[model samples]
Target: MLLQTIFYVAIAAEAMTAALAAGRRKMDWFGVCVLACVTALGGGTMRDTVLGHYPLTWVEDPYLLLICCAAALITIGLARFMEHLRWPFLLLDALGLVVFTILGCDVALEMGQSPIIVIVAGMITGIAGGIMRDVLCNDVPLVFSSELYATVSIVTGVIYFFGLQFGFPGEAVIIAAALIGFALRVAAIVWKLEMPKFVYDKELR
Candidate 1:
């Protein structure tokens, strides 16, 4: 039940982010809906495909599809207001990353995957959607360059795995992992924290 709640919240958050991206691009309603669905469900779809989990969630649950479309439409109506509140959407995106990471870890662990695979799965689930979103929007994916985006997902997975290994209650582990991941993301934004970039200069080479 807790997982379901988190999953829905994550989807909604992702859909809103997608909608905002679409708005920036001045896409039509159909385009907005398409991007919203891709951003909201693309990560889980990739995870399930890799894990051989059949019948994708959106396919099996049409309501989730409806939710994404509805979210996009709502965002369209409030695009002007949302333009001034980008920080809230950024926070929501951070929350979505944690939720997706934990859910992916849970799924991989259930499948008896190794620690490494579980962590990788979590990262994939957390970032794939955003990757697709940026690709469609003609922008570099945030995961590839943004402050601690993918790092937060990996850390969340690690926290969840170790918390369970240490025998923490499941609910406690979930809350702890989410809070820690969200804090790291918020700190990254506030402090301008980032991983060092590798640059290639043709002249130097």
Candidate 2:
């Protein structure tokens, strides 16, 4: 039940993020909905496909698709209000990232996947949607350039795995991992923490 609730929250947050991106691009309502769905569901779809899980979540539960569409529509109506709530949205996005990471890790664990596969699945579930969103919007991917975004997911997955291996209660593991991951992400955003960028100096060559 807790996992399901977090999953829904994650999708809503991701959908809103996508809607905001669409608004920036001045897309039509239909385009906004399409992008929102892609942002909310694309990652899970990709993860399930790679894991050979049949019947994707959105496919099996059409209500989730409706939720994404509704979120986009609501975002359209609240564009100005949303613009003023950037910090809130950033926090929500951080929460969503943690939830997505937990969900991905849990799924892989249930499937008896190897440690590496579990870590990769967590990353895919956490970042694939944003990658697709950025590509569609013709912008640099947040995971590629943002402060410790993808790294947060990978670390969170590792933490969750170790927590389970060490016999932590399932609920405790989820809550602790989510809180830690969200905190790291929020701190990165607040403190402007980032990985060093590599700039190629062609002139030197």
Candidate 3:
């Protein structure tokens, strides 16, 4: 229950950021809300489906839907404050990645998944929603951006994987991962850190 609550709050904040970005693209009010909800929940839905859970978490809990709706409304109303949205979005994204990663790994661990498989599943769940959001928004997603995005997820996932092995409280593992991920993300952004990219060479026809 605690993890779920944290997930909702992180997603809600992320939704607000997404809505602000979507507004600049001229999305209608309804469209904005849709984007927000989709960005917030799309990944978890996919994670649950991949794990063979029917109905998904949000579907089973109407409170999740209600939370999404509330997030959408709040985001739409705050559209004029686009400048301040960036920090919160980045923060939420990092925190969400860590929490989701831990939750995914924890779920897999409970389901008897092997350590390696659990880590992979956790990493996937961490970044899935952001990927969906970026694709839908027609922008280059953060994960694809050469930033420290996926690195954060993988690191946190690994942390959760090992922490659970040592019998750490699941919540503590999650919180530790979240803090690390969030800090790494913020540091990367602040330092303009990114993965090196290769320059594509065009051959003469």
Candidate 4:
């Protein structure tokens, strides 16, 4: 349930961003719609594939894809009105990352996986596509940015695992982890927090 919720939320967010960006760029109607759909569905498709879900979640449930498509189309048509709310797009993306990261770890734990593996999977599911998208778009990946994006996701997954180990309620664990990750992400964005830069090794030089 957690995973599904995160997937849908991500789709909605990406579609919104795509539509808004398309409108600002004055893209044609078809181009706008296609970009929105791609943004929305791209990440989750990779996730499902990595998880070994052959048909993929959107394929198994056409309505899910339809929701993304409809959201894209509607937003594209109304993009002009949304041009001023770009901050909402950033928030949505961060929110989705937090939720999805938490749920990824939680789902892994529920499936009787090891904590270490859960953490790794959760981080990958959370940011792998964003990394790919950034590369494809010739932009820096959030993973490589100074915003502590992966750190936040990593900590959230750790929190969820530890919460579960401590006998906390599963739903509470998921929510708390999501909140922590989101809070950290927002703080990093607002305050410009980042991981320390790596120092060059004089020996290697």
Candidate 5:
């Protein structure tokens, strides 16, 4: 029940953040809702398509679409105040990344996917929506260069999967994994920690 509650909150949070992105682009209200739906649901949609999971998440639960659209509209109404909540949004985004990863792993486990595939699913769920959002917004995708975003996803998934395999209580595993991933993300942001980038100024040898 706790997990499910957090999942709904994360979905709405994702939609709200995506709505803000749409506002930054000066998108019309319709465009704002569209982007919100895509950014909040696109990752799971891609994951379901890849895994042959039928009906997709929003299709399975149409209310999810309503939640996204409603969140987007609320964001549109509160646009000015949102600009001052960058850090809070970042924290929420970090929380969403870990929660989504754990949820994705659970889906893969239900499908009897291999461990690697489970981790991959978690990573996809954590980052792919942001990638799609960036593409639509005409900005470089932050997941490609952001501070330990996908890394946190993978770490959270690993901890989640192994914790279950080791017979830990589900609630304990979820909280531990989420706390670790969230702290890692917050640290990365504060310290500006990033993966090594390959810079190619000249032609390759």
Candidate 6:
């Protein structure tokens, strides 16, 4: 029950941040809602579609769409105070990333997917929505350039998977995974820790 509640809150947090991004681009109300939905739900939709999991999450639970839209609209109304809430949103986003990854891993595990595919699904669920949002907003996806984003997701999924394999209780594994993942993200942000970059100065055929 608590996990499900946090999942909903994370969805709203994602939508609110996406709403702020849409506001930066001067998008209309409808555009805001659209962007919010994409940012909040796009990752799960893609994960499910790729896995052939029927009844895409929002399709079966249409209220999730309403939640995203509501969050976006509320964000617009509270835009004035949002600047001060940047760190809060960042924290929520970090939590959302781990939570989404765990849930994605759960879905794949339930399907008896291979270990690698399970981890990949979690990574997709963690970062793909933000990628879509950035692309639609004409910006670089943060996961491609940011500090330890997808790494955090992959690590979290691996931790959860192996812990469960080692016979840890499900709830204990979740709490441990979420704490470690969230801490890693916060550390990355504070230290600007990042994967190495590859720079190609020449054009290749």
The digit string of per-residue lDDT tens for model 6 on 1-205 reads 7778989999999999999999999999999999999999999999999999989999999999999999999999999999999899999999999999999999999999999999999999999999999999999899998799999999999999999999999999999999999999999998999999888899888
Give the Cα error of residue 190 in candidate 3, in Å.
1.2
**164 in model 4: Cα distance from truth in Å?**
1.0
TM-score-wise, the better of 2 and 3 is 2
Best by TM-score: 6
**Candidate 1 residue-wise lDDT, 53-117, digit = tens:** 76876788889999999998998888889878789888888889999999999888988999999
Each candidate's TM vs. the true structure? Answer: 0.95, 0.96, 0.89, 0.79, 0.97, 0.98
lDDT of 1 at 155: 97
With candidate 1 superimposed using the best TM-score fit, by how many Å does residue 12's alpha carbon deviate from the native? 1.2
Candidate that would win on lDDT: 6
Whole-model lDDT values for every prediction: 0.91, 0.91, 0.77, 0.73, 0.92, 0.96
CA lDDT for candidate 1: 0.91
lDDT: worst 10-residue window of model 2:
196-205
| Candidate 5 lDDT, 8-81, residue by residue in tens | 98899999999999999999999999999998898899889999988899999999999999999999889889
Each prediction's RMSD over C-alphas, in Å, is 1.4, 1.2, 2.0, 3.6, 1.1, 0.9
Candidate 2 accuracy as TM-score: 0.96
Residue by residue across 52-161, what tens digits does model 4's lDDT show?
64576568777876776678787866666775766777788888787767756755665577788788768866777566555544566757967888888899889988
Candidates ranked, most accurate by TM-score first: 6, 5, 2, 1, 3, 4
As for lDDT, the candidate ahead, 3 or 4, is 3
For model 1, the stretches where C-alpha displacement exceeds 4 angstroms are: 203-205
Model 6: how far residue 91 lies from native, Å? 0.4
Q: TM-score of the candidate numbered 1?
A: 0.95
Total backbone collisions, model 1: 0
lDDT by residue for model 2 (1-205), tens: 9878878988998999899999999999999999999999998889999999878878889999999999999999898898688998898888888889888888899899999999889989999999999999999998888799999998899998889999999899998898899999999999999999987868854
How many clashes in each candidate? 0, 0, 0, 0, 0, 0
